[model samples]
Target: MQSTVNYLWHTDDLLGQGATASVYKARNKKSGELVAVKVFNTASYLRPHEVQVREFEVLRKLNHQNIVKLFAVEETGGSRQKVLVMEYCSSGSLLSVLESPENAFGLPEEEFLVVLRCVVAGMNHLRENGIVHRDIKPGNIMRLMGEEGQSIYKLTDFGAARELDDDEKFVSVYGTEEYLHPDMYERAVLRKPQQKTFGVTVDLWSIGVTLYHAATGSLPFIPFGGPRRNKEMMYRITTEKPAGAIAGAQRRENGPLEWSYSLPVTCRLSVGLQTQLVPILANILEVEQAKCWGFDQFFAETSDILQRVVVHVFSLSQAVLHHVYIHAHNTIAIFLEAVYEQTQVAPQHQEYLFEGHLCILEPSLSAQHIAHTTTSSPLTLLSTASETPKGLAFRDPAQDIPKFFPKVDLQSDYTTSKVRGGAGGSNHKTPQISQKPARLSQRCHTPNVVVGLCLPIPQPCPFSVLPWRFSSVSGTPEIEEVKRVTELKSRLRALAEALSRCSHRITETQLRLSNLSSELLKNRDQVHADRSIQKIQCCLDKMNLIYKQFKKSKMRPGLGYNEEQIHKLDKVNFSRLAKRLLKVFQEKCVQKYQTSLVTHGMWMREVHETRNHLRMVSCSMAAHNTEAQGVQESLSKILDRLSNQLLQDRAKEAQVSPSPAAPYPSPALTDLVFHMQELCNEMKLLAFDLQDNNRIIEGLNTPPSGS
Candidate 1:
């Protein structure tokens, strides 16, 4: 059984409870439509009448998808209590999502973007209506699952909101403590006795805090004690000049605060996204309202991001993956052109496969629509040609290799094809090919004169028929040989790329290692345990020197004493004085001196042990890096040979006449494949070694268990 709120709506469940009102999931009995009913309690009714009136008026005037929809206002039957029926958001608030353990580090990029777009839109609407939602934290934003499965965030909880224009100011303080601006925090949270007026930028401050929290799971400007318990410190942190602009106080009292302008490594957002996003965050989170970005600039930048289409593409020919962010509203043709720019594969040859079906290459189709279909997986880019069928094993490589050697074979053919007139005015005749092995360049142009291959001329190969030259002799052994040559060439290029990436990674590792070593040495020198003991020992040495200097001096008459008193300082009195002084010194300094000696010894032992371990680790790393460099040199040599062999094979393929039953895999092709396999294995081993070395370096960089 459901309880009736006003006999017209049935209250099925209690949605949430707030300070002044209790919300419930209610259904209209007459229309059978679900809605959220905000039933105001006695406390809510007791609030300032103007505030109540303003909230109702603001809600009534505003209308946006990003803002919760207000349905109707009704009164309860029993006590004639007032209630507001609004759009029901079934997904709850963003706070619940952030509270999950998986999101402890922050929301994932996609979800964070959803939050960003929605909040910006909602705030834009509020500004347009001349209302400031003084409370703009995550809890005030409700979530709903759209028909397309995207999250729709709506700004809610308007109890603290009011009408305020851009130039106008409001004296009332209202907002969450953590997200509050410094001026508001000073007056509202710290309860300082000061009067100040707030403009529309207060909402920007709250939005900044909300975005930071959405990007990084924790609030900014945290104190050693929490924001509530140490309100003064929080205020100081927020108000501190210069560094505090993009800084947070240490959560614990360990050392001086080290301000970082960048987000932590734990944040899930990519570096490219972070670069664009950090500037927005910096602008919005500005401590000075004058320096902060207004709604116009903020909207401009954020809309720029929202408008970009990010397409994830996978290349079937090269076996590489790419994320293409197109900065335009692109059609399918434009999108494919963008992919061609990234992958170097022509748009004509590009065929995309989404959800195991061929994506229509209609030029008018929207790229964003295709992206939506492939959200679960990347769009597969396939190489296509008219001569070779789509499922051929070797056609893609054959089609792609010409892109690499577009001029090499053609130039050789042109240069070696020219024939001079015979001495007796007889016409020169082409020679017949033989079975004997010959140099590739000599064989290519011995039969015909093909000139002007290197110069800027129309391409000798017609792209309409086939992308490769071997298409002239299709269904022959020459085609098989051409396929084999292209395959090996493709493998060689891939290997070279792998080697380059490996070398780059090694260089980065070496740089990181050097930095870690420098940091370690600096820390050892500046923050060493022995330094404390050394300071104590230095103080003791100074004390001993002063004592000796005093002992060597004669009894001074001018040492703040009368002549009779000085004379009265006999040996007995002096001995008694010395004894008391010694006793006090023993009580005060002797134990400390002993403890310092022990500490010094312990520190020395630990330092020596650490140094020895570090020395061994460094020696091992040096040896490993030396071996890696040697392997890299060897791989480079192998790659050069493979490249030369591939060029020669292309030249030979251009010269060889078609045969019906020639061997499928020639000895040269077999040998080429073997060398490639060897190079690949060596690269794999090198990769494993580099990974191990990285782990070792990482271990050294990691701080000791409980620093």
Candidate 2:
């Protein structure tokens, strides 16, 4: 506290430090809310730099939900001690979340999509505002501690953000080396500024690289080692790392892994995500700037993919999405590679663990019956060249893996699987441990909520073209029953959160009604206004019913449907299910909220019209006051002349007879003076009327005024 830079901000703890400035977690003395302050030691800067000034200007002007907001700049301690107070993200960096091996299962597919969508949205905002977040790395993207939990991520760090006018190309080279586009990377490596110019498209390239790295938990383009030379190293880059290829993309031949050719997309992914995302990465990873898309083009393509359910993967990062498609022609080898990625233990050390049948998930009935369905116990993978986890010195991974469903069940890999519920297993397959319906097993210390098990997914294309049938779960007890029930329990908790937010809105609306009434009273002095209080109350009550359902969820986990109905489901559409659920808990809310939203629109129009009216009245008053002043000035001169004449006449009368009340020379003169008094009184009355009008207009425009 004693060494504080600003009294207005109470600097509590140091958050991070950069090359030029240090960031501190500080509290605003006035608001008492926490903020982050990037304090710069101006002694080194001496004079304000262009880039730094632009950073502040850009931050102050932009207002996007996904981008971090800037509050103000302060130089409290002295002129040289400058600080930029900005919004704080207490949940920390996205890099920390992605890099942690501790997140063994990693982030869920739904969560990963949510993060990507948010980041892209923020980038689009920055692009539209004529700014490029040159540093679009994981370190700059952070999760905010918000009402939506830690799922909301924001893009920050404008230190290297570029502000360009239309048709302007960026000439300066600034940003982290790892995230730089190929052209920028070449320039940095060469240590000499080239005449080549680039646009904000560099940012899109960076984003693509960033996405790939986050998905795989490994960098897509790591610079190879060199003899640390100043200028000569750039020349060496060409000979060192493999360019124009998927460096870490994993591939399995019948014998060994072509590890260098593939990505680390080792995580269990959704059915077709591997194919969907591979081209996206390639589209963004183009080396030639001409072929690459600008901001508008990038948004169009990326948004289309994001709107659909993104490729879901668990256990693996984005690095390996390529492998699934690359080896699709031969499903046998691809199946082996999937196992290698899932184990997190390399293929070499743990081939012995999978002894039973390696079953794909259920395929369509027509595909099942029409295709040759043979049960083979042979799914041997590349036992020698599986990419080992980063830190293992030697030896094999022990058999102590986490408890998982057999038959290569991969629920976590993608957001949703397309495979239908159950298909008959016709092959004389061994009665597998995979066939048993998943039972509820309590983890270390979870609540009464039951855990879910994922059903297996069948291989695609060439694998289907192969003569193999996916092992099925025993038909006596359905897998859908277990999954639907368990999924229902977890989903109820999320629905409860939604209901709570709705209740908060209803309460806020009620408070607004009170304020609105007082505001009308101020404008009219005696007032009445229309309000939809009844409808709001109904919506509130409906929301409570939904919340109550959450409370009783443990006993009645069914979503108001019988087991018989759910069992009949061979295929399910979640969008339709969600609509039905909304119909149940949100009947009144949907109807009333829509009506209120319309009312809100009308209220906005009225408020806008009121402001315009007040402004017009103020202008009209100014013109009227000018006319009044002219009349008053003319009247004053006449009154002054009359008084002077009377005074002179009175002096003459005093000489004849000493008298306090002097007589008028003529009756006509007395009548003229009376007329002057009448005109002055009329002017005074007009002044009072104008004053009252101004007061009313002012009160109407402002917040509810005092009595």
Top-lDDT candidate index:
1
68-111, model 2: which lDDT tens digit per residue?
88988876454546678888889778875663332222344456
Against the reference, the lDDT scores of all candidates come to 0.58, 0.46
lDDT of 1 by residue, 365-466 (tens): 666556452323666655552221111011111111111112222222111111000100000000000001111111111212001101111111111211
Candidate 1: worst 10 consecutive residues by lDDT? 423-432
- Residue 246 lDDT, candidate 1, scale 0-100: 58
My TM-score estimates for the predictions, one after another, are 0.48, 0.43
Provide the clashing-pair count of each candidate structure.
Answer: 0, 25
lDDT of 1 at 56: 75
Clashes of 1: 0
Over 4 Å off, model 2: 2-12, 43-48, 103-107, 223-262, 268-271, 309-707
